[model samples]
Target: MGRIVGIDLGTSTSEIACIVDGTPKLLPNSQGKLVTPSVVHIGEDGGVLVGEAAAEYLFTRPDCTFMEVKRLTGGGEVLKAHGKEYRPEEIQALLLGYLVRCAEESLKEKIERAVITVPAYFTDLQRRATAKAGELAGLAVERILNEPTAAALDYGLANLKECKNVLVYDLGGGTLDVTVLELFEGVIDVKASCGNNHLGGKDFDEIIMGRLAEPSDSADPSADERALMRLKKAAEDCKIALSTREEYQVSLPFLLTGAEGKPLSVEKTVRREDFEDWVAEKVNSTREPMMSALADAALTPGDLQVVLLVGGSTRIPCVKKLVEETLGTVPRSLVDPDLTVARGAAIQAGLIEGSINNEDLVLTDVCPYTLGTAPLQHGIFGRRVFFDPIIPRNTTIPAEKSKIYHPAVDYQTEVTIDVYQGESSDPANNERLGELNLSGIPPAKVGKESVEVSFSYDMNGILQVKASVLSTGRQVSAEISTTGIKAKAPLDLSRWEEAEGARKFRPLIRKAEKLMAAGGDPGGDVELLVRRVKEALLLKNTKEAGDLRDQLLGMLEALEQLLQLQDDRTLGIDRP
Candidate 1:
């Protein structure tokens, strides 16, 4: 049988692994290293380079190198490198092909099928994009496993006899994912997963570079592509150094030219304390995801037996402190965080290939996003269509959920089903997955004729939707496409007007009202902002939503403080 290798296709770095001699091991790349830099370079000499060679190419051919292509996966974003344009997934395919070649050379055998890991929060578009990249690279993608889930699988397998609630904190180069998993007997069930794909160690590197680079409205011609690339490399090196050292010296000689046309230089010695202070806000951004995961699982930090740290970013001393403070425990650092995902992928590959006989290692995943359809709702502003989630986020995979939707008009014999993925009360506010058309339904009065729509999300992340007429047993079904393009636009639901505000944020508004009822004085300002933010999000005004969210968050913080003080007074205890 052909090998079903496990691949950790990452934004900043990638690794391939396979089970050998009853154990999972990372395969060394052509550079004889386990961690391959996810960098590709189209050479000036009409050649191609990947990994270490490609990463370093930035020093001389900055415009020719492509790094972090994983960020653009399924985003419909485009890139240009070395005067040649490429889709994000195409770049990924090139890198995957390189890794496959390395694996083939190491094993002295062909590898066809493989399991690839992605962020759990990856949308249908992103998930399918990763799988398609694998196919473009000439490998049959066996499974698309979540990165945190893969790591948990590896950890769970190692401690098979023990039961634990393990929280997986994965902060890699370009994203942050926090997942809570229940490991019982031999079954591993993911309770919850949440993350921000735009945040990670790369942000820290950019922060450091910003400190060294001069800010100006005009271009610093002296700091050309090469110079900027040099600064980036230097920032990354210093970041790694500060992980173990108290301080690191950064020096860039002949880095650029000043406006005066003189050769400029950059030299700075950054202290570990200073870096930690500057990056504190970025560190704090990760807390929401952790809290969200715990909330989804109905768990507290105290409920977690141990926190498992994964990804290279966790090596930062300050990051560890943040996790310990938030989770109320010293996180387990024994596992090789950077390689865990790939190694676990190898373990999964083994299972798929029948190379491993551990049938007790039962695994279950959940739909990372809400599955819903647009439905009519009566509101204060009259009738409007809102997002109606049939299956909410965090629901276990291989699970089924159904909801009855009724016709909006009398004697309506035709209906169009628009499926979306998100947890928004407003339909247009979420990602539209696909749409379906059903006809020949028995006509009746408004809200009288109905159909039961069921969403069955399997472990593979594919969604099977079945619509059955209540008057008749007539049924129609459609599957969410892995390519994500199956969802056609101009959904024919445009006539469904939206009031927008006071929809999704209704819960927050009520919570604020409760606090006020309990003697917390948020005033009308908090309520006003909530209403405004909802309108902003509905209007697709993200800038306004962002500003309002900050204001709302601050008001909530103050209200919480008031509640805390009230509790303290009630207990006759001093405020600490």
Candidate 2:
């Protein structure tokens, strides 16, 4: 039997790890890097290249090279390369196969079994697609772990004696997940999880890309794949650079040819303040999920003992500040934010392989979405289809819940159980997993025919539904399969609103914006302060915003004094 390894198959990068000497350690790739770029390129000779080797071709061979395919998993989209069609999972499989080969080489042993991690908000179809990718890579998947839960495992193993309410804020390359868990005596119990799968660092990069192409004289820089790829690469670099430095110079020479046949370039100095402003709305979008997760866990900001930052995006200064202000606590990155999830998955692999004692560590996770069946009901207007939930969202896994329902029509003999997953009251707004048709019900009045429906959700997040006809004892069950189902659009968060107090800062915001536009401060301090105040307002951090408002007012007064002093000196009124 080969060893079991843990893999974090991410949108921007992928990593492989395993347990060594009772400790989880990350395995390096062929390039001697801990993380592998989630990129693949197919050569004209039908050869496949992955990781760093494939990344080099992203600009030159844009048609055959694929990146960020993790975002397309479980969707009904097909990618084309050199006249060959490839599914998202197939591309992911190529990356997975490369990771496994790297692991085998690093460990000097075969690896045939594995544990994989996915975002907590990933739908059933996405999870199934992830597992399918693992299978396609020729490994027996031991478990499909949630990214936040896996991060908690890594934290818990090191501090087995400490008991604390921990929140894991995971903002990766392509997804955001907020999970609240309790750590007690080596047991990690996840209370609730919420997130936006479409929001992440990639979105921030796109914001930068727009800014980079703003000065181009070309009609459309995006019309050329090579030029677009160049812009994307540069945008990503600029985003990473501004994380540490206050400003970064983005200079891409000859990005594209203009309509006049002259080459146009992108020359811009991106300030961190401007970058934060550009991404403020998207970054602020994470606040709702954090509050939702904390509320679902029945926890207050004061109750949380620790906030663990996970994923690469958490490194952003604005993101870190958001976590601190929203949770009323300083966030901690005990482990490398980029590598913690993989380490946790490695620990889980250790547990499943009998290397780490099961009694020493135990993990329990929750279903991130609600599971239910659509049933007919009488409404004010007429008969309507309503979502009747059996297992609510955030319910601990390996759970079973049953609800008894009656047929809607008189003398009904059959019923179709349409299962859906979401928080909406209407089934049409939710995702349809699978359905079961239960017939052979004895003839009876609508209210008398009772059909018992039960839902079973396992630790792996797979759902199984069973429906039984009470009178005839006829039953039908199925393990919900998401195969052939198109993934629904991203969740709608347009209705989210900031706290009521955010309104009170409008005057201050307007004043700050005016001052920023005047631009007399040489250090750009006024601009930075203005951006922070706006972010605080967007995040609904009244206290932080108020403090920043005071600071801005003071700065404005000082600037006014300096300007008056300069005028007096120029007019010879204060000549000494």
By TM-score, the best candidate is 2
After superposition, candidate 1 runs with Cα above 4 Å error? 44-46, 217-223, 411-414, 437-444, 466-477, 481-576
Off by over 4 Å in 2: 215-218, 484-576
Worst 10 residues of 2 by lDDT: 487-496
Name the lDDT value of residue 357 in candidate 2: 89
Q: For model 2, what is the error of residue 219's alpha carbon versus the real structure, in angstroms, after optimal superposition? A: 1.7
Q: For model 1, which pairs clash?
A: 222-257, 387-427
Measured on C-alpha atoms, candidate 1 has an lDDT of: 0.82
Per-model TM-score versus the true fold: 0.80, 0.82
Candidate 2, pairs of clashing residues: none
**Model 1 backbone overlap count:** 2
lDDT of each: 0.82, 0.87
